[model samples]
Target: MITRYDSNNRYSKAVVAGGFVFLAGLTAEDCSLGIEEQTASVLKQIDDYLERAGSSKEKMVSVNIWLTSMSYAGGMNKVWESWVAPGIVPARATVESKLATPDTLIEIMVQAII
Candidate 1:
């Protein structure tokens, strides 16, 4: 069985199948914010989506994080460190890359179990 959430013509914000939920890359709605603010906002969005998908941060299996530049990683990590509990942290990879927009500082993708 499969399920989709927050779908639009372009793509679903998340898809659930085979007992796992796969989320699309998400960026803060207000990209003009700094890295810490953007990361915090995106983390909140992740929490909301996880709940809607019948999971939580503790269920997250993997996370892929992208930052517009390596310089912003510290600020982003600060926010990430606070939101994620120590033991429940998911397998994650953070990389420097160009984002969808110049203003967008970071983007995150996640996978979680049902």
Candidate 2:
């Protein structure tokens, strides 16, 4: 069975199905922040969502990150490395893409075991 949380008109913020929890792409609330701060904010949000889904970062199986510019990758990585569960790093990919908003520098989506 599938269970969803934080639903809105557009989509659910997270969904649990097939023993996994999938989170929608999340961005920092304050888009004015720099890459590092935005990355940190997004990670924190991920942690909260994972916990609410009965999982944690250590249970993550995959992650997809998008940056508005590749130049911000280094800063994004620094925060990612620090936030990821040590020794249980999940499969991850980072790519440059145009985000939904001009001020948004980064977005992250994740899948974790429930």
Candidate 3:
């Protein structure tokens, strides 16, 4: 069975299937936020959804991150490196893209098993 949450007109923010959770792409709410703040906000959102699905970041198997500018990769990596689960880090990829919102600097999606 599959469960979806935060449904609306546009998209479901998260979904759970079998023993895994898939989080939708998420970006910072405020455009002026820096990479660190944006990363923190995204992670927090992920945590909330994971908790609801009976999982956590440590259980993540994969993660995909998108950035509006590649130039911020270094700074973003710094925060990501610190937030990731120690010793059981998930496979991750970071890419540059023009986000859906003009002010968005970064967006993240995650897949995890409970």
Query: All predictions: root-mean-square deviation over Cα?
Result: 0.7, 0.7, 1.1
TM-score versus the correct structure, for each prediction: 0.97, 0.97, 0.94
Cα lDDT tens digits for candidate 1, 1-76:
8899989999999998999999999999898899999999999999999899898999998999999899998899
Give per-residue CA lDDT, model 2, range 1-114, as digits (tens).
999999999999999999999999999989999999999999999999999999999999999999999999999989888888789999999999999999999999999998
TM-score of 2: 0.97
Output the lDDT of residue 8, model 1: 98
What are the lDDT scores of the predictions, listed in order? 0.93, 0.94, 0.89
The C-alpha stretches of model 2 lying farther than 4 A from their native spots are none
What's the residue-level lDDT of 40 in candidate 2?
93
What is the lDDT, from 0 to 100, of the residue 46 in candidate 1?
A: 92
Models sorted by lDDT, best on top: 2, 1, 3
Residue-by-residue lDDT tens digits, candidate 3, 1-114: 999999899888999988889999988767688888888888888889999989999899999999999998998889887887789899999999999877788999999998
Clashing pairs in 1: none
